[model samples]
Target: MIVYSNTISGFNHDVDQGIIAEKVHNELNQKGFYNSINEIRSWENSLFYMKNVLYSPSINQDLNIAIEYNIPNTSKRVDFLISGYTYTENPIVLIIELKQWEKAERTSREDIVTTYLGGSNRAVTHPSYQAYSYAKTISNFNSYIGDNNIEIKPSAYLHNYKEEYRSELENDLYTPIIKKAPIFLKKDTIKLREFISSNVKKSDQGKLLYEIDHGKIRPSKALQDAISSMLSGNDEFYMIDEQKVVFSTVKTLVEKAIINEEKYTILVEGGPGTGKSVVAINLLAEFRHKIVNYVTKNSAPRSVYFDILRKDKYSLNYIKNLFKGSGSYFNSSKNEYDLLIVDEAHRLNEKSGLFANMGENQIKEIINASKVSVFFIDEDQIVTTKDFGSINEIKKQAKELGSMIFYGEDYNLTSQFRCNGSDGYLAFLDDLLQIRDTANYDGFDGDYDIKLYTSPTEMKEDLKKLNEINNKSRIVSGYTFDWVSKSNNDIDVFDIELKDDFKAKWNFSNTQTWAIDKDSFDQVGCIHTSQGLEFDYVGVIIGKDLVYRDNKVITDYTKRAKTDQSLKGIKKNNNFVLADKIIRNTYRTLMTRGQKGCYIYCEDENLSKYIEFRLNKVLKKNN
Candidate 1:
């Protein structure tokens, strides 16, 4: 997928004649690729300088050159790649990251530099570190790199920076990365050419580039071992009988579609804790040979999964390609992926971009991107207005696209695996919350622990005790509290205030692994952070947004926090019923996150009494 590839002699000729940028742009346009005018301008500037550096008499003109080489199964592309051989005839590739930054400032974090980008001063990866990571990702994922015993050399060339700014780019914090992949500034053009010439002494006539582009891709042995070790002895990875049935059915469908070269959309519908994520991960691990990816809209579960799978540094570089956000397929090629297992499909956004003006429907894009698209959805989990991933909508889109949709008992997971396999508990919850009617409205017979708390402090104390035993318990709340800074220096201020001096901070935004971080137990996670995740025990704080009024659950959109983006403008909408439904759905999803037990603290006294009445008098009467 290289946008431009040719012999070094040909590239030099094109660049020397000042037509290289136009040639690359014409090729990209012909391929239906999207690139902004600003990006093309940067490419022209960088390539013009690159031509000067590679035009040295010592550099071999017959070497292979490629620009904008697309990384397989990913949205990223390398800036430039040169393939040749050293004097010993060993294959070598020089991965160059070209930057046009005239100035950059060191950030508080290592390997991160701040520069003016996208109309604002933003933190971006240091060029050298970026190049090194790109090279490492290729080495870890590309089978050809290992099979051919190729040597990869990564470097960054900042052609617009002055010599005095070199100190900032070569800071002590970035010493290790710079040692591995040196940074070349405008003054270091001669040195950069010398480094390039030193590595590539002979030309391979572009054979190496062709092999890399056309090589068979498989998970590296190290990656396979890492995944196996992560899944081994993990009880959560084990699937139940119903789960196994669904897994077998979906796998067979995917295989059949691939064999027949046909398109199929398999929808797996289940409520919370029906093992959707468990089945999705198992499918991902088993279907390594096929071009499969796990897609989700929420970052919390995806980040937690990545953290759990790639505990070591070696696996982290390659694991990211396996997981993608739902929006990543907006401009993807048709039928590019063999299988796309979309987890938490209910969270898929309608559109992407900062203003949500870019791209068309994500559902259509996902369906168009893959031959066999398997979507695991929970209709009740549509917590936001933008989420349009209903089973009906998916079916409609699939029909419009001329793809067959398969959903029935074979696709529905009935057996509950969470809350200690307490199906009655879920039924009782549905009835008590008035989200829907259930047979267990009056009583629930289950071993799962459920309790209502009079105070938030008591619920926190109980959660602490539970966490001490298993370390898989935390307090989560409705988005009712405003996250405000108490002092200029303290950003993680106590946001959730309660009586008896009980106060806690909202979960840290930077802690993507909040569910697993031991220190995060004290912070209260909102719905966005807790969705698609499970814990041994959960403490839920029902906020003022929901109340029990006139024997029916009522929703007050005004009670929701101003900081909560999901609930924004719901109060202004004319559809009160829809708003209430979304609010109830949010609470239901929160309460069901606990695998074995759930403790509750409600802000509304009337709601608390109603919950108790259902657990006690109503249940006893029904019995």
Candidate 2:
């Protein structure tokens, strides 16, 4: 939906009189949209410059103009959109991204530029790339764009930038994006006008804009093809007997809910490596007619999935809509989505925002926003005190919302898909970690590979060797190292320093695709970046937060890094028990991230000896 729309002549007239900003603000307030002072200033600056360019005599005055057009099913909005017809009477939409930046610098990342934004120098998407991505998302999701044969062209206008400062914005690294969508500077106003008039010479009387605003949306063909390509020849997507049963049951429930116009909530509980994500992705691919989305609180799993499915430049736009964050439903309309498959529900936060006070509980909002909400959760994966997602909370919210709850063994996935499909390794780890005593702690004799190393250096070397055979191997550590270098450019600075010259840096904070980045194997991943993800072989570095003492496992919250927000304010006497649980849960989650083997190196010598003794005792008992 667009906040404001009018003919080109009307828009130019309003901007010339300095009343367009107020007009758009009033319209947004009428629609119950939040209005910020900065947003109003941006609207004033961008629209005034847009008016100056569109006022050319050669530009058609009857072409339709839309401002602040919201992308479908997302909170993102485009700056300006112009819809009209070309000389041959073909419908065309020009997506214009306006920036008021006077300066920008190149960054070491792809498709990102550093600029002064939000009171600080931060990295942001390049204007041309941003505009192109928005246009592609619309073309891939909006049914009208596909059915009506509308051509979409994207461009960026930096009206405040001077001609002499063009080299910074148009560097050799940005040639591909500039070629895809030309960037117009302040001195290029006449060229910008020519570009607009060349594409949209005729007027459509706002009919095409109206159609786009009220388009019937379905999964685009590109979305389906992307999913198909990702799932091809991947045996992991195949479901076993129990997983198939769960999938069939949930599919039936969703169909019934859609027909009856009723809300349904299904809680699918499983342990680590039980194919929860696999089932969620399969359902998303199968339910094409319905408005479906896959939600998660952690970006690790989502990034890996996107990196795999986004086969080409255009595929990323279509594939992004299939996944969303848990907090994306803050201001959503009730029952707007047909199905929301929430993966890793254990990571859902109670509140979301910079200060964590913007919205209500995410669980309640998600329940209220969809006709069918399927949550895939593993309660043991809640590694932080802020994570409050539990089966009881979901049931209580479902009961309060008057939605039918499907809770039973049929909805639970008991079969294991990871760790070489060995459920015994999971039970053994749980027993060894003292999270619970489900299995005998004598020894782990399962087919899954398990080893303990006294030196972190040797473990790293072994992991690197294993990665050569299969690239799906990484080293993960506890939250005891300072990651200050993550924000700084010195990502190569070793954050985790150990004896014997074993040093490694934490994973790059801006590395959205850390799971697939070529240089990430040398870095150590923390719990935040490794959870909800699996590797073929994993090397774990147990920090000093956990140690063995007095013939029992003990925890010291003080050993955790001050930068780690998960265990910020725990007193030894006041919250020791709870702090211990969270720390153990973090290590447990990290240890189980491997699907084939797990190698461990503990910081505390006592803890290492204790683990070795326990394993030897178990071996003796088995013999």
Candidate 3:
């Protein structure tokens, strides 16, 4: 597909927008390294270990070089250079051809689809394929030289050269595997590699896959870790022993009820690792809320929001305009909303304004915005950040809103169910990082809510083991917060294909076909797609970039940013806090997505430390 660089208006051209044009040009010019002929030559020379005979003047090499360097012979500057030789002294040793790299302009629709799907649309061709084609062409180029050298007419030699080049091209480009020796072979070596390289320049599968895993291919700092964790299968949630359930069983059940609930001003008190943002989105879907506005304490959370908007079938631009009151994308009788949900509500306090003079506190504005308001809070997660909303403060706001009191359901989902259910690590986290808290379940004797595993490889192995226990009943899958780097007609390339099979497997038989780079209905899974939807099991990927050193303990973004008073300091720490919030929110979302249990993959060493620290505290208290 033709990817148009950001455009400049006619006015810009008339007014000498040279600087802007230069900027645009620079950005567009930044294609992959192998997209040019100059790059191929540079790369070939850099290989440093090729056979010297190929470059030497051994078998009629002079004639071959002369043909390539000849003037006025520009027949599309033939990329394929083939030479064959039967030296009287060397005994017809070799035949060689070469293929030169060219910045290929995408020529077909299929090219766009594959690149977009595979998430490498930015890269013109897979590096491996490019290398192989170049080698094949090079080999074929050498086949043109034979012993009859002087006796053979120029026409016959030229015909041989063309045939050799064409033969190699056909085999390398169309065959599944290279039958003849193709000096280079491209093979996938990592996860998702096979899927990405399945098709050739026929499709933009790389970019598409990148979008599917993350919202955009190159995510901002806000979602860097989350996206990485998700793609790598590093985020998950587990159950603590009877004593602690951070995303405890009770909390999960309660969340399910709230999502299923049609009426009421619901309040959720989620512990750390209990997915509050995920629950909010699910609840929005269940209730069919007209406007689902999500606000979080960090840039990561905002990135999460973007992921959901872009991945889901809902038109993001339409949704964005809904807030503007200018578009006709959606219509509703009520001016306010059917329901209002706030995640990380603890991060919003008396100083934050929600609406016109509703109150400085966010809770007040939330209550005013809808008939039924759902506030998901965690006082501990707030961690002394400025404008931190306390549970007590929320209770007061609820009273002022005149909403009937609903029993607060606390989450104990602290099973540390990731890293192969490592309880030791979980216990370590609770003891080291969290503020001490008690639960009534502590009195009972039972399994440690936390678990431990050797490493990520073991974690995946354990998942296979768990799946074996009950394959149909317990579906083990993952969630990612990846980014989409390319777009087709303003639609995300990743969310375009809503797999009929994936939907059917998930029991969404009625789900419509959603285009990967176009707005479609089945985008919600993790942060990229799961904006206004829910799932039975959700896996979250939390990374270390989200954590910052604060008093030897990892702190959330709200605590770091809002608590800092100096404007300069806040700006300086903006990235740090934003990173923290996104990671934290990712955990919150994953924890809540599960109606039964959540899985986690946390590659960030710091996140693992934090999880271990929390689990340790829970274990110590139980002991």
lDDT of model 1, residue 509: 55
**What TM-score does prediction 3 earn?**
0.31
After superposing all C-alphas onto the true structure, candidate 3 shows an RMSD in angstroms of 27.3
lDDT (tens digit, per residue) of candidate 3 on 397-454: 6787665545432222222222222223223333333323223212211222233332
TM-score of 1: 0.61
Query: TM-score for each prediction?
Result: 0.61, 0.62, 0.31
User: Each prediction's Cα lDDT score?
Assistant: 0.79, 0.80, 0.33
The true-versus-predicted C-alpha distance at residue 250 of model 2, in Å, is 1.0
lDDT, candidate 1, 1-623, per-residue tens = 67899987799899888888888898765543546789889988999999999987899988899999765433357899999999899999999999998888875554666788667775566788778767876776579999889998999999999777788888897899899999999999999999999999999989888888877754212121234454443322334334655666667667777888788998998888777877887778767567888899888887877876776553765567788888888889988888899999988888976678878988998999888888999988888777778888889889988778988655677656677556666777888888889877665544466889888998899889888875689999988888764232274457889875678888855588788886889889988999988887899999999999998888897798877777656657776777788889999999988876889989999999988887675435433
lDDT of 2: 0.80
Between the candidate structures 2 and 3, which one is better when assessed by TM-score? Answer: 2
The local lDDT score (0 to 100) that residue 156 gets in candidate 1 is 93
Model 2: weakest 10-residue lDDT segment is: 218-227
